[model samples]
Target: MLPESHASPDRKRRPFLLLVLVLVALLGVGGYVAFQLGGDDRAPVANEPAPETDQPSTEAYQPWFAGYTDLTATPVFTFETPDSESGRDVVLSFIVAATTDACTPTWGTYYTLDEAVEGLDLDRRLARAEQLGGQVIVSFGGLLNDELSTGCTDPARLVAAYDEVIDRYGVSTIDLDIEGGNLRDTVAGERRAAAMATLQENRTAAGTDLAVWLTLPVSPAGMTEDGATAVSQMLEAGVDLAGVNLMTMDYGASRADGDSMAEASIAALQSSHRQLGMLYRLAGIELTAATLWTKIGATPMIGQNDVAGEIFSLADAAQFNAFAQENRIGRMSVWSLNRDQTCGSDYVDLTRVSNSCSGVDQGDQRFSDVLAQGFDSRPTSAAPIKTTEEAGQIGDLTDDPATSPYPIWTEGSTYLADTQVVWHRNVYQAKWWTLGDLPDAPVLNEWETPWTLIGPVD
Candidate 1:
């Protein structure tokens, strides 16, 4: 049922503080990832494989990407992950433009048409992303913004605004994210048709090959006959309709009922997946992307906890995975990654080679004691930084911010990031690395886990 050791009740749900120790041991301490530090200015670099001598001869691996933070366009560095088909593969993250600031409509104020278009016009944000499924479409509506649907309801004005956004963002596709509205309203059908008409008009006027898409509500009640008919209207509009992105979260919000965050997320994904399948069959339209959940943020309907752990798990299920696998709809785009905590969950450890056993395997007793003693230390070593390949083979990089001021000193090491040193395990096979010698050890952020492993090497 659980993915691996990750399923253990102790590992999955340990005391918050103790869990930090285990995770730190697994990931490492104060090692800033190459991408996170580079920020928005970073650009895509041609991937150069490490030389044979440097890259260990191993089996090949499959590479799946993680989406980058919002507002960030380029990937800081491509890293390797363990793979079954291949020993290793590179996963490329596609970062898109998500307006969480003034673009949000949750607080009562809605962005005007001009402001909405301008906010979504993030250059190089989605422009240079590696194409997982053609152009990484710039999504318009999300959990925050309601004006895109409310204000841009006019056929002519909406078309013009749509054109401006596509041209400005240089995106080949668009995701129409109109969420949470009753389909029985008087203007519901007209409003949706007008929206589709705007997309068609924009496509023709811009002369750019554009795919118009909608993010439909997943529940049966959310998709009444009127709602399903509105979706069919888009097909008749002669626009190259892409696919519906299921709003696979916030299922309980319909009834205003309370449900576990995880269960709500899974239910939404399942409901949307089932509804979309039926709609496609009845409407006789071919679908492109089976994407889910347009955004992830602080709201109860679409929060961070359910988005990553629960929603993603549903995405990986056998049924959905098969559809995605077979149909080339392999892309899973979260509306914004910036909204998520860089440190991820609270269970993350923030300490260096110290042995608190947060998430890492603990074999060294002394290392654990040292971590507790110098808990606030930093790595002060001057050794050359190892490449990601080297880091993977060697011991995990430490994430402890406390060790930021110290150097990383290896006590008994088998290998330190591709460099063979005199480090050896004890008679009982205990191993350790000293933080006193590592230079450029990461300084931990309050929200950051000191033991979180990062950087290209990690």
Candidate 2:
């Protein structure tokens, strides 16, 4: 079901808004291609040079994680409250590099989790954390980590693996990080039901509290107004959801703002927190986690463009503290800190984070300490505002081969000009492009054009 907010008679089934960049307008096209080609949620985006901008001060945050660290090897590090603070909130995240068995990718070649894990040497890290009584977790999948996608989407296969992890590692929870991947032609409900069934089955077999966490996309800060409808569609399908983790980093892609990266990221994080949390409530769900990233890249390339030489350093520690204090969010999960540049070598100093990073007493060392303090806080009323004239509506092109992939306004809407709809595949949603810029696009023949179908044109 669409969120009640969008289910009214006046509303149409469409996304909240579209960030249609002319140069990167191809981004939407590429996203559709990746969606169709990969088949689930694992499509790849064309790597392009990111736009440039001045960095904000050390206080703000941006949109997504440019890079991450896997903690599959050593598990334990003790974090303490800073000397002057009484209590501070925290968020700790860990990624699973890989498993031992081979899992086939939906599109690409097959690879084993062992390949990823062995290379990263994360098991020793996990064991170390276990010995020290630190709460080390295992995150499954990433932007292109396709193996887990193969294993996790299937109920039977997922159940077997879930049992093995519990027995072998005594892990009580597992996180699923599904980002740009595949999009199937299958009905949305069918996909959601299948995924949810798998999660429920795996959880039942594990016998412990099994958590399934998802990291979602947020364009810069709270630019979710554009994607809110799409998100509602996802929830209706049943993706075995537990909570949402907003990858609140890299807002504006940081091309324009060079100096104030941290401050920018912080502001974006706060806006994203408020906006997304409101959307979740309007759609009826809980906001479980709010996390930040260590750094963001300038382009789609994996590691080439970092925002600044060093991101979120101790100099910026006060920024995070202040932001968290204002938002009342419980924990702050910094994207894997292992990638941060230290005195000479790259090392993630978790202690540099907040008043809680300094060494503390043993009794205070628990996973609970990592939670953000304001998890229960929320606004009593929805933010007041005037709705956009262009409320939620699907793109002009339906991509349905049954009809010409041309832009046709629905009965309730008006068309200013003819539109072009491109169809890429069976499962693809139609794409719309304005005819204004296309030098050779077919012009709408008003005299012979069908009237009611395109709606009464003004």
Candidate 3:
């Protein structure tokens, strides 16, 4: 989402009393008893064991707090504020291609990496946030501007651009918010998938984790065709995708007349879960329902969405958070931390979208407070735990016609769309007319081959 032109107003600090009430509401009576027994009113320490509850522990819940911070918003966001009431983990967003050089990354196409370090005081603030046990996940791409992969056609240059940002930021997790033309361009999608696959491989070989998440626009029905293709390209290129985070806002005509914002978001998430399950299966990996839930995330525009009549309120935030915790979604994020607070009386139009303040009534309630209710973990903690040895192992089993469910694929044969064949002990379906392209080709891009892997032989 693009920022509005209005200047930022004075910051309002959350009251300490509100924090205590939030803690009590989240921790229940058992926690209050423990607090009284301890004879101290200090907030619980980070990573401390939570008091016993009938529901699942915070550890079991996969909802980690990474509220998006519009780095280039007006008046700037003080993410490193020591006593800030917002959650510790912040998602510094929209690291897009530089206006001059597509291969060079810039923040919202406004400041170069070094320039941001100086002008935004980014490096020092980031260091201070880390000192306070806070981590940041850099998000690339947004509603506007060109994402690096779309602008940099050369695969090597694209990979280098991604590497530069990852290396510079020292971030293990990155979110690719593909939308608009970037999402629909099949060629760019292929290029991105290949580059990400290479980047992940390099990081894996170096004994470092590079968790990648695809943030795409979605509706209550589920991910659009282009959105699904974007994800398919990533998986087909061998990128161990961390998760699929749906932009659960701006439904427009997609939302039913009677549905609340929370209801619509939940429906979108539920549909996305099913869609992702099928996508994973097509990539020859089948995940359990619970495991697949962890591979999904939801992000709603906090308040006053670009689409008229769409406002995600505080009540909606609470309901959505409850659903996320219940299903153990991998991550939770809002449109921006910059807009978490309510607008002042100066704002003449509440309907007009603002970057500095949320155009809604927030009575001692920050969107971050409600959205990040039980998400106590960091973004890095969401990375899939795997050893280098396990990652290095590759299966080389052959397909046998006796055990296969379909006829063995042959290079000489031209296959039509929907034609299923067996290759290397896996089932694949042809997406279009093809000949000589290997179903098991060691191609980086999905468009390089005609076959789509359906699953391993059962």
CA lDDT scores, all candidates in order: 0.30, 0.30, 0.71
Cα miss at 292, model 3 (Å)? 1.0
Task: Write candidate 2's Cα lDDT for 1-458 as tens digits.
Answer: 00111111000111232222222353222010000011122221111001112222222222211122332213322222221111121112223224444323111122233443464434564565445434433444444434243434554564455445444444544444434331121232234335544655555675434544344444333323323333444454443343344444333343235645445445444334434333443334532222111111111101111222323343344444445444333224444322222222232442332111212222323212222222232111111111121111211322354554444323333334333222321111113333222221111111112221211111
| Model 1 Cα shift for residue 245 (angstroms) | 0.8
Best by lDDT: 3
Which stretches in model 1 have alpha-carbon errors above 4 Å? 1-135, 182-189, 201-207, 219-229, 236-238, 253-323, 326-331, 339-458
Candidate 3 accuracy as lDDT:
0.71
Best by TM-score: 3
Error of 3 at 2 (Å): 3.0
Clash statistics: count for each candidate = 69, 67, 0
lDDT score, candidate 2, position 168: 46
**TM-score list, all predictions:** 0.39, 0.44, 0.73
Task: Pick the winner on lDDT between candidates 2 and 3.
Answer: 3
Error of 2 at 266 (Å): 2.9
Model 1 Cα displacement at 314 (Å)? 9.3
